[model samples]
Target: MKFDAILDPDSSPHEVCELGLLAESYGLNAVWTSNYPSSRDPFINLCPLALASSRIRLGPLVVTPYEMHPYKIAKALASLNELCGGRANILTGGPTGVNATMGMDFSRMVGRTRECVEILKRANPDEALNYEGNIYQVRGYKPTWATDEPPFIYIGANKKQMTHMATGIADGLMLGDTTERRLGSSLRLIEDNLATHGRSRDDLAVSCLIAWHVKEDKKLSSSEAKRHLALRGMLDIWFLETFLDAEECKIVDANRANIFTAYKQKTDVIEGVPDAIVDKLVENLSMSGDYDDIDGHIETLKRYRDMGLDEVAFKLHEDQAAAISVIGERILPAFQSH
Candidate 1:
């Protein structure tokens, strides 16, 4: 499995670009940024990365349809691709959490996202794309110049309907919440959808996003895991409940309820979480542990490869440079040997 880095929007552009350059130097595949409403604009922030890194591909891991029109996405992507000599990828998603956070409507996000992808494809190759849809309309829109090739367009999806639509229309599929069992089921869903379209599994690249925190100290690892889960759990409750199973959804909802209840009761459930509880939470929600002495991380990644994931992007939560170094010094070499 190939490794990539995800830049948090809270990070500064200079920090993101520096990490991108370091990732490139470490021989990683790409650097993707989040497009959450509160975050910095990914395309704009990526300019320094485009100028600084020669090889690492840059793009949003997934931009929401409600946040920007396809025309703008196409324009930004085209410009970035040209500037980077054709090393940009565009990953998009139907608006959910982002829209909710930004107070944008999510009702027409799926239809809008489809139209956006079509517009992007047409806008590439310097062709005027005339599009009219329920949510957006574009007439005779084309970029001034085109790159050698259009950026790869991936769709972020987690539910059955979204998976089917993505497999039918997208260049690739991006999945998150990457536990081994979840990865297996997600790949199966993608394969099943592709088969329905009379397409082979090889026709699409499956990218899994794993929330990762690396540390040698068990206590620190546990704390990091708790912090990650608290944030992700809140987001999932707000946006991803539809993608989860009944039991999983219950857990998320119950957790959210508990957190809110604690808030109302003038207490802090999140702060009071102990190390043991954090360890359990990490095991349930994230792919993290000590990756220094043994090949545990490598073996876990190989399991992802075995499950038919084409790529695995580690969404590092801390210390980007050190994370890259660990991946370069330990994880990448292990994968290459295999």
Candidate 2:
């Protein structure tokens, strides 16, 4: 499977560009920055990387149509693609944290996402695009200067309805926080949807977003992983069920405040939850531990590769350069022949 590096939105444009250059030197496929309301504009942030890098694809991750119109998305994406010489990529969908912060409408998210993807897929510089969809309408819009190859358009989908929608239309499906135990079901769902749409596995690409917390120090790695653990699937019961028991899942659910509080406080202290349970969650949900644990992580990644993943994007937290080096030196070599 191919590997991609995902950066936090807090990273500045220059920092992201430097990191993208580093990733390119390491032979990584792509570099993506998180899209959040409070962070730098993702599309603008990637421009520097797009200009500076030659081989590595660059773009923003999970930009919902609710926050911006499909036409505008195409405009920015096309501009970025031109700068990258056609290596720009994007993941679009709905129900992001932006929806909560902006109080945007969430109804009919599936249809809206479909329209956005359709608009992006139909974007062409050679011809004017005039589309009329249930949720979006574009008239006399033409990106005449965007003559480079079209940017890869991915749907940020994980659930059944969204995954099914992606299989039929999107260039790729970007699943977030999907673990090994649940990956089979997710893949099956995509396969079933592709068959129903009269499409094959080769028609679509599949990738998952995994949290990366490995550090030089095992204790520091575990601490960072715990501090950010609350973001892993939001400690959802469905994800916890893969490792935790019924009562333990209940405890986690009941202590949601503690988990989120720990994250907010920038510490690893998750009060009211057992240490064993927390460890289990960390082991099952994220890739953590010191350098010694990388070989084992490589094994887990190999299992994912064998399971038919086309790509896996590692979400880096702290010391991104170190994590990128580990992935480049230790991880990339393992999948070179695959």
Candidate 3:
């Protein structure tokens, strides 16, 4: 399986370009810039990286068709791929971030994502014109100058219907913040869906985005993990019940505002929930701690490989180069064939 990295769009273009060079030198398969509603434009931010790097694949992590039209997405992705000589990728998904803040109704996410994928696939072919999908329509639209090396399309999916449809349609699937226990059953459903399409597990690539926070100081690593817990989508009753106790879950549920405040501010202070609770959640939801934690992280990743994952894109933060170093030296080697 391949290993990749995801960077927040907060990084400057120079920083991203430097990180891209580091990632390529370290032999990372891909470097994805996340598309946050509040952050810098990911595609524009990643341009320097796409221009600087020769081998590592580059693209925005997950773009919503609801926020950006599929036609525009195709053009943007095609442009990036052209810059990379066809080493670009894109993860299409349902509503997220600014979409929710903008009060965008994405009730038809399944059909929308499917149509987006179809449009992307058709865009790759030379003869793409005059096709109409329920959610997206193309009327004799063709980018004749578009490169033949179409970016691999991956759909961000978590639940059942979307998972089945995305895996069956896109080139691959990307799961966000999914833990091992959750991954076991999700892969089975995806594999079964692949079979229904006359495809096998080998045909459908699977990958998950996991938070990585290994630091020299264990406390610093844990703090970084806590800062991003809200992104884990753990507010639901069922998800909270998994690692949190009843009263603890209730406490977290009650302080949803506080958590959102901290998340929005990008602070490490987790009000209502105890630091211990935060640490536990961090440990379970992300890979953290110091050098001694390497063994455990490898074991966790091994479980993912066993479950049929093709990659794990580790979402990184502060001291990212150092984090990439540790991963390059530790995690990548563990998964690489000697």
Top candidate, metric TM-score: 2
By lDDT, is 2 or 3 better?
Answer: 2
> What would the per-residue lDDT of candidate 2 be over residues 1-338, giving only the tens digit for each residue?
88999997799999999999999999999999899778889999998898888899988988988999999999999999999999999988877778888988699999999999999989897788999999889999987898898899889887888988889999989888877888878888989999999999999999998999999999999999999888887777877887788999999999999999998899899999999988998998999999999999999999888888889999998899989999999999998997
lDDT (0 to 1) per candidate: 0.74, 0.90, 0.83
- The segments of candidate 3 whose C-alpha lies over 4 angstroms from its true place after superposition are 245-247
Clashing pairs in 2: none
> Clash pairs of candidate 1?
none
| Strongest candidate by lDDT | 2
- Once fitted onto the true fold, the runs of candidate 2 whose alpha carbons sit more than 4 angstroms away are none
What are the runs in model 1 whose C-alpha is more than 4 Å off?
A: 231-252, 257-278, 292-294
For model 3, what is the alpha-carbon lDDT of residue 170?
85
Write down the TM-score for model 3. 0.95
Q: Cα miss at 218, model 3 (Å)?
A: 0.9
Candidate with more favorable, higher lDDT: 1 or 3: 3
TM-score of 2: 0.98
Order candidates by lDDT, high to low. Answer: 2, 3, 1
Whole-structure CA lDDT of model 3: 0.83
